[model samples]
Each structure stands twice: as structure tokens, then as C-alpha cells.
Target chain A: MLRQLEDRYVHGLINKSVQGFLISNHGNDAWVEIARMANLPPQGFESMLTYPDSMTDKVLDGACTYVGCTRASLMEDIGMFLVTHPDLEAVRRLMRFGGPTFEDFVLSLDEVHDRACLAVPELTLPKISLNDTGVGQYVITTQWQVVGAISLVSGVLRAMADDYGALVVLDVGPHLHSDGRIMETLSVFIAEPEFAAGRSFSLAERLA
Target chain B: MTSTVSLGFDALDGLMPMHILIDKLGVIMHAGPTAVRLRPEHDLLGMRLFDVLTCVRPACDGGFEDFRQVIGQPLKLQFRAAPHTRLRGLLHPLDDGQLLLNLSLGYSVVEAVSDYALTSRDFSHCDPTVEMLFLIEAKSAALSESKKLNARLDEAREAAQTQAETDALTGLHNRRAMDQRLCDMTQSRRRTEFGLMHLDLDFFKQVNDTHGHAAGDHVLLKVASILREETRANDLVARVGGDEFVLIFPDCTDVTLLDTIAARIIARLEEPIPFGSKQCRISASIGTTISSLYSEPDPDRMLSDADTALYQSKNAGRARHTLFKDAFEADDMVAH
Candidate 1:
């Protein structure tokens, strides 16, 4: 999420990801219905632009209603889609740059926002803080304008764990902070570091 | 502790994965595991170091002492292989007068990676090359997405422009489009002779007043199709008013041709159009003028002259065509 001088705005990349997830997982007709329900044009979101925060909220709500799921789950699905979709392999590669292993990636959570900003300067992802509670457990927290930021992070973590052949469980919930800002908390536990043989990753891509 | 410590080959290999050890004769004694992967088909143990790598900077000869002179200085070298991958490295002196050269693929890391099919394991964990590769992929992806956005916006803009220039009810060129075409043809540097015709429906008001606006709309649609059928692909036919249409024919200034076109259009309009169960009857009056008739072609004057001839046809009795020159002469005859 990134805003201009005054008004809060969400980048079109996020909305476009939502649209891509819905259209590819569901169908184009489902996306059309959701867009119509959201009072948006059937053309859907453009990935290089920006829209008002209210419009994003409406689209999320409309998608939740259409998909018969909670908004958090939909956002989580979108996060996984961003990583797993072949069309968005660049996102997966970027997340892989966090570290070599899933545990290293979890430790690099606090730097995710800075790394993303460096990659795409306008995309100001939420800042995350992680606390290593025990040998295989961690507590992650963040305050963002978007309600599903933590849920999306959980989904990305889950997908990355699979990418690295690790097994992890994730739990997410929202709580009110003393400063009156709504903050989300995600609890993570690594069940098995070596769950399965992971997909092989090369530092450089081969041209066909 | 000893004043000078000796390092083992395994320790050096682990510390610098791309390091190469050369003897006093400039022959490679040992290469790090990652360095050996560069020339997998050829063993580097007995090969001349200068034969495999050519020094690109610091102006050095392919000799042992020349390598010794540039030990701590910055070095640029290139592989003498097909891809000619470039390398940056530093050289240090060993206790046995051998050279320990640690190499890194400078900007050619991308090419070398793809050429060698190297993975993250090929470099040390502290290496930033993988992160750089990630940034490159991310930026390119973002750039491609923006390019798509630009293309889509351009398409949307062109569609909006076309919609703005079209008449909603009949899907023909609107008045704005007609005016633009008229101005363009009249003011063009390579002005070509063209015929302008102004036409008005003869009994359209009576049909609208009798059968209601729906029947009028049906008759107008039929009229539009007839006009389209009567025009060439390059000809301009526009709905400029409720009951008026303007047609421009480029390179068509012959009066007889204009008259024939007008007659065919009038005959087509005279046919009854059925809206539901009611047959709506309508006719048309046409006036013609040519750009060659005026000393300097002007859009406003031509339209006004065509309108004057159309009104003359209306007064002379409906469903007839009147040439502007003929109407002007007829007015002269009346004044005399």
C-alpha cells in the first residue's frame, strides 16, 4: 500500500493481483460479476496505476461475497497466487532473495518492506517486526492501512516454506493497539525444515 | 603464534570458491570448485593460466613475473572461451612463490550464470550476485507491466475518440466529425475537387408527428443504411441534424454523377419502412455543390450554398435534386 500526499491509496499491482487470482483460479465471468458487484468497470484493475483505498475495500468485499469466503482468506489466496503463478515468477524469485532457507527467510521478515521498496520504489509494503519466541516459533506483527496485510504475509510465508521444502503452520488475527491503530499478528511454527524435495532454483534464468 | 601462517588448499578453496592457484611457471596447479565449473570439459591442473585467461587491464604480459607485478593491483581478465565471459579479481603471493587469484564475475555474472548454469550454491552465502539478479528480474517485470498499461490506455483512448466522433442513434459520423472532415478537405494543401450534398427528409416530420418517435427512429435507421449503401468507402456521410444529412465525395465533381447519386438516394428513401406493424413513408430533397465552383474552397460557404439549393428544391416541390449553380441562375432569372 502507498499513498500520495493526502489521500490513502493502494497500488494497482495489489488490485491487479487480486483480479488475476480471481480470473485465473475462478473464471473471467466470476471476475466480471465481482467487479460489477464492486461498482467497478468490467475492465478491472490496471497493474501500473493507483486507486483510492475505498475502491480497494469495495472490491475486497465484493470478492468475499462472491467467493463465499472471508476477506482474510481471499487476500491470503492472492498472496499464494503471486508466488505460485507461473505468470508471476518474478515475485517468487524476489522472495527467494530473502534467504536460502525458510528459517532464514523468516528471520529476514523485518527487512521485507525495505527490500520491496528497493525493488519497486512506489510499492510501500507494510513494515513487519518479528520476535523469535523459541527454537521453532516466531511472532510477527504489523500495522497497515489494508486490513489483510498480515494474512497476505502469512500466505506468502506458507508458499515460500513449500518453495524451500519446509513445513510450517501459520495463524493470523487482528488486535487493537493502545495507540488506537489496528495491528495484525501472525504466529508461525516450523514443523519440519525438510518436508519434501523443493523446486530447484537457479541464480540466473535461462533464455529459451 | 608463528609470525607467518601457512594456509591449506582446502581452506583457500572454501574461502574463495572461484580462486585459482598458479605455480612459478604460470601453470595452474589447482582451481576452486566453482572455478573448475567454468571449463568443465577441460582440466585446469596442467593448463597454462595465460592460455585460459587473457589479461584485459593493467597492461601485463603472459609471464610469471608480470603476474607478480600486478599482485595487489586491480585486475580485469576475460575467459578465452566461446562466451568470452569477463572476470574481476585480485592476486596474492603464496609462500612457495605461487599466485593465489580469487576471481568474481563482475558485470558478466548474468552471462556467466546462464552460460555455466550456475546456481546460488556456486557462490558464497555472503555474495550479493543473487540479490542483484533478483532486482534485475523484478525491475524488468515492472517495466513490462507498465508497458502493458500504456498499450491498454492507448487502446482505450482511441476507442473513446471513435465513440465521441460517432452519432449515437445511427452509428454514423456525427456533426463534429462531419465539420472536421469538411474543414480538412477544404483547407488541404493538395486540394482535390469534391462534391458536397446537403439532404433533408421531405415527410419526416409528418411521420414523426403521426406514428410517434419510435417509427421516426426506425425510418432514420433505414435512411442511414441507404446512405451508407450509396457512398464509397472513402466518402464521408454524416448525420448533422435531426432530419438533415451531409455527404462528401472526394474527386467527384461531375454534376451528372452527383445528380444520379442524389436520385438513387431519394428513390431509396421513398420506400416505406415498417416499424412493428405500421409502414412509415418518407422522401428526401437534395442539393449539390462542387468545390471547383468557388475560387477558394471554404467549408462554411459550401455548406451554406448547398443548403440554399436544398431549400430551393423544397420550394419547387419535394423529392427533387437542385444543383447550386442552377438554383443561383434561377434566382437571377426571377430578379430580371
Candidate 2:
């Protein structure tokens, strides 16, 4: 089933996908190829920009398949794009205004979405809650009636942590609730930068 | 050339989403259509922002400058609607020199309904996070209830086990518990040295015959208390039979110590026990045996040998203790 998303985010996703594909050495016509693979007409993605809402899953799936990357990776790329995008400066400013620290930014994600809805009334943002499991450990839960795009939220969070230069370990899984809404839980362990660096080296050695 | 879209002030006000407009002085200038619907009775237009609502997060000091500094930042504010509600939003600076307060429910919708006594129909169908929050809350409550039930069950089991091992009349360990203690002691290889003293009260039946059963029970309680006072904390004292008791002393094999203990118990038992309007004197004949003298220790054999010594003590004069091995050696010498 297709998940409906606000047109602004839909346009933003296409632009970022095309740019990301080109940066990764994919051809300039990657957008066209992805559109064709998703069983849409040529240049159909361009029409979604003016519409109030559009089906999001087909575009995301085609982009993932063409780039030979998982949905999570693509979403992460889009999240990073949102932070760095030139035309989305206002959105970037709003996000940076979350707080002075990276943890504060993470905590403000739900409020950020609430503000974003003022400009785009059609936006259906998930509710995000953070539980402090222990020192340097947190469990973030997102409950949404919408079927997809939850991974995009996760990507944004990781990018936010990166913006602060904080090293973290993340694990994501879906918990199905009786109310029929999918609750995505993300377990995060914020590691000391030095310890994270050491762990990366050890992991590399084991892989080798 | 850029064309500016204009609506009349009232038309613009009607089109606005959930918001409140506050002037530079932190006074509410206008309540948007959605905000008015949430709280219709209150006249919020002239009220101070701090008087009408409270800042919940990114805490402010309730000052005008503090409120201004929060512009363009995500915030949580609780509005004093007819029914109170918390809203999450950001402050936007409008061209007309007023701040627009855009609001939406910051928490789970189900919790909002539960806390505010609103119905499901009150909330839009877009978000089900409220339902999910309710599920989580229910699960936590169930887990706490299960833990309490398990604790209660454990307490009841412990109480039942205690009742099974205790003598109802004397509050001492009954014959069954004493047998179990003997088996445990004999089976333990670490406890090579042990002593058992078997005591039988002389003329105990005479007091029961003269007085009622209540007096008999009182006398037994008194004896049990005295035995508990005389024995060490590590020792076990049990009422093994009517007018008969046993004391098990673990990790002790000194004959002299055993004899001293037996003598003390005899002297204590010989004291006058006073019932209502009557006084009775009783003495105890005790038999002592130590485990170290046996080649292979057996609980049953130890008990039987103590009983034999007790029989000798009863036959000798009914007021002293007889050590089984000592009496056996004396008999051998006489036979020689």
C-alpha cells in the first residue's frame, strides 16, 4: 500500500535521491531510471511537487533498488541532505534551534514536527518518546498510524547525533501494538568518542 | 513584481490554524479559531500570557524577555483551556509585530483524553500514539501486579512450612522436626563431634492428675521456655514426647561440658513451678551421649543409647544424669 506524504517532503526526497545517486557515481538520468522502475511515467515525479500530498513508497522503493542500498541507508542519506540542503535553510535553522546540545536536539524532535505541521497542515508526524534506560543509554519509541517513512525519522536522529560529533550505537526494531499502530523502538548507546574509535578499529581487525 | 496575498483581518484570523497571537508586552492579542474552540468561555485576548498558560519545557522564567528569547524555538506550553491541555509549538515572528503561537498536542492523544476526560471522537484519526501509550501503561501495571502476587505466594508458603515444624502447645520444634534435625546432623561429614541429651521430667503426671489440663499446658510452656534459655543459640531443643525433651548440641564432644549442661538442666527443672493457688516441684533425669565414640554414627542408634542411659538414671534415684559409656565401663569393672 502507498503511504501518503506531504508534497514538500516528497519533492525534497526526489531532489536528494537524484543528488545522492549522482554523488555515488550513478548516471545523471538516475531519477528517470528510478521513476521507470517504480512503474511511473517519465517526469511523473516533477508533478508531485505542486500536489498537496503524494504516494511516497513507490519513489522510495525505486530509489533504494537503483542505488543498490537498503531503505535505511537511503533514508539516512536524505536526513543528512535535509541538514545540509541549501534551499531548506529555514528547516535547518529550526532544527538547530532545538537546543545548544545534541541530546537536546534529539529530545526536541517531536516538538519540531509539531511546528513543521503549521506550514504544512497535511503532514502526519509520528509521536516520539524517549526513555532513559541508563547512563549514556536511551530508548526512543515512535508510534505512527502512517505505514512507512518511520526509517526517515531514524535517519534524521542519527544525522543529528553526527552534527554534534557524538559517537553512538543504534539498534532499531518494530514493536506491533494491539491498537494496530507500528511502534518503532530505537535503542541508542552514546559511546565516548575515544572508545568508539577503538571499537571501530577492533571491528575492522575482526572483519579482516 | 511580487504580488502580496491579502485577506481582511477577520478572514485572516478565521483561516489561521491552532495559534494564539501575543504582543511584545506578553499580552494575548488574539485567539485563533482553533484555540477559541478549545476554550470558548475564557476571554483570552486581554490576558497576560503567563497568567493564561505556563511554559513546560526549555523552561522560562515567566519574563517577557525570556518568552521573547524562545521565539523560533520548539517549546511545550500548557494552556489553561476550560479543560487544561498541553500544546507543543514554536513562536513565529509575524510582520505586524506580534508572535504567533502555533500549537498541537505534544503528548499521546489517548493520555490527553484520559487526563482531560475527552472522548476518542475529540481527537483526529491521524495519530494513534495515544493508544500505544495506553498499551504500554497497561503492560507496566500488569507486571507490577504479577510481582505482588508472587511475593504474597512466597510469604504464604513460608508460613505454612513454619506451622508444619512447630509444636502448637509449647511453641517448640515438634518430634518430626527433631527427627529431621538428627538425620541432617548424622549425615553431615563436617560435624564429627555432637552430643544429645534426653530429659524426662520426674512425677510430671502427678501435677497433671492434681490440676487441670490448662495447668499441664502452662507447665509445658514454662519448661520449653527454660530449655530455650539454658541451651546455646546453635543448639536445637525439641519436645519429643509428653514429659520428654531432647537437646542436640552440634560441634561439641567434651564429656565434662555435656555433664555440666545436664546438671544445670536438672537443677533448673527441680525448681518450684507455681500455678494459680498451688505450687509444684519437679525434677528431671537426663541421659547424655556423644557421637565421636561411635565408629559409624547413626541417628537412630544415638537416640536409643541416650534412652538406655535415661533408663539407668531413672533406676539410680531419678534426680541425676547417666552417661552411657561411663555407666557401661563401671558395670564392666564390677563384673571383673
Return the interface RMSD of model 1: 2.1
Task: Show what share of the native A-B interface contacts model 2 retains.
Answer: 0.00
Candidate with the greatest TM-score versus the true structure: 1
RMSD, each candidate, Å?
Answer: 3.6, 25.6
For each candidate, give its TM-score against the true structure: 0.88, 0.40
Candidate 1 lDDT tens digits, B1-336: 659867787777777889998988889988988998897626578898888887889877677678888989899998887778899989998888888899999999888998998877787767777777877877787888888989988999999999999999999999999988888887769687899999999989999999999889888889999999999989999999999999999999999999999999999899888888889889999999999999899999999999999999999998999999999999999999
lDDT of 1: 0.86
DockQ of each: 0.62, 0.01
Question: lDDT per residue, candidate 1, A48-86, as tens digits?
Answer: 787877788888898899889998899889889988999
lDDT of each: 0.86, 0.68
Q: Please give the distance, in angstroms, between residue B61's alpha carbon in candidate 1 and its true position after superposition.
A: 8.0
Fnat per candidate, as a fraction, reads: 0.79, 0.00
